[model samples]
Target: MTKKNLLLTILATSVIAVFAIIALMPFFFLFISSFKAGSEMIRNGLQFKFDFQNYNLANYALIKTERDGIYLKWYLNSIIIMIIQVGAGLFFSSLVGYGLAKYKFRGRNIIFILVLMVMMVPVEILILPLYKEINSFKMIDTYAGVVLPFIVPATGIFFFRQFCSGLPTEIMESGRIDGCSEFGIFFKLMMPIMLPAYGAMTILLAMGSWNSMVWPMIVLRTSEMQTLPIGLQSLLTPYGNNYDLLLSGAVMSVIPIMIIFLLNQKTFIAGMSAGSVKG
Candidate 1:
């Protein structure tokens, strides 16, 4: 290679590395600040220090929230919602995606187009209508109300459709010849082979559900039904700042996602990359 070309490559790589660090430095700071005391919040803002023992683990202990405001309840709600969303949404999406990719049927193209249109439709637009519907059904202020709206996502279907498009068609045919029913083929073969897809979809759905604020807030008006994201908002009362509790809650919220991503990072990237290449 030419010397100038080599030098440019090194320079470009260094710049990207610097930028990546700059991007991630805040998360590092956030995690560390979670361990800091109220004084640390006042001193250097979010990026200060590493005094790990500033707060004890017991400080964030599960307490029965006065007037049904338990952090543990909210934590459980978020976790349950995450599981339901990730599990059911991924299941239905993958089934639909595989059917679309493999089956030849009437109005197939039109159906695919409809799926795309659904993806294009914004989530905000449905809030008012959904609210009215939930109100009618009396799901308001319940876990079902908190979770049911999230049971569906066009984005998940679109993503799975894209991923499923790249799989070998003959494998599905082979399953059919082996006396497998369509449902059998999906569970026995397609779902298993699509582990990478599942990992990616799980992370995405979980994070979206876990971080959801507006929809959960709307349907779950009662504090008892609050998810972690909405519950954390309560930590900041009107009168004064509660930085320590806020940061602790933030840490608790962030840790689940952080751990999930770290565990599945490689497969997650592979599945995400599959979208463009496979589609």
Candidate 2:
């Protein structure tokens, strides 16, 4: 490469490295603080210095044992909710998106327009009516209540629609010529074709469901049904706070997200790039 090109590349790399450090600083401090005693944390405020004497596994152990291992229960609840939401969201939303993208039926454009409109509206604005609807159905404090409202996300539909729009209709015609059913073509043919899209949506849906707090908090009145976000908030009391358990639990809660990203890194990147260009 020319000298000018080499300099530009080095400059870009340095800028990215600097931003990466800035982005990761908070997480580094969170991990470090999780190891420190509450007193030490209060005194030092996420200092870089590591005092081996002040660090212990007591925080993690306490989290595991606290309230008869309710933290595990909350973690499990979040996992179950994430799985159900991602599965249902992918299946139903993608189907709707595909139909909207490929089929020409009465009111198809109207439905797509409505989906777009819903996407523009903030979730916070709909919370009141949604809570009332859930309450009327007597589904409050149940897992269904938490997972149902988000199962067919507008954002997922829009994403899948854009992705599907770029796919060839010839494949569907080929499947029809082979005497395959519509659902079969979708499940067996299109699903594999849309793996990247699924990967991208999986991360988005999983993260949203896992980190959801306000809606779950509103619907789930019982402590046992609470997800990690709500459960973590409960760690703070008016009398005293469990900073060690709080910070440690927060660190542990991030594990599944990191694992998801690591597993789908390639597909996710491809899906995002393709979707952006196609959309």
Candidate number with greatest lDDT: 2
TM-score (C-alpha) between model 1 and the true structure: 0.81
Pairs clashing within candidate 1: none
Tens digit per residue, CA lDDT, model 2, 239-273: 34477678889999999878987888788566433
The window of 10 residues in a row where model 1 has the poorest summed lDDT is 270-279
What TM-score does candidate 2 reach? 0.89
lDDT, candidates in the order shown: 0.75, 0.85
- For residues 183-212, write the lDDT of model 1, one tens digit per residue: 998898777668788888888888898898
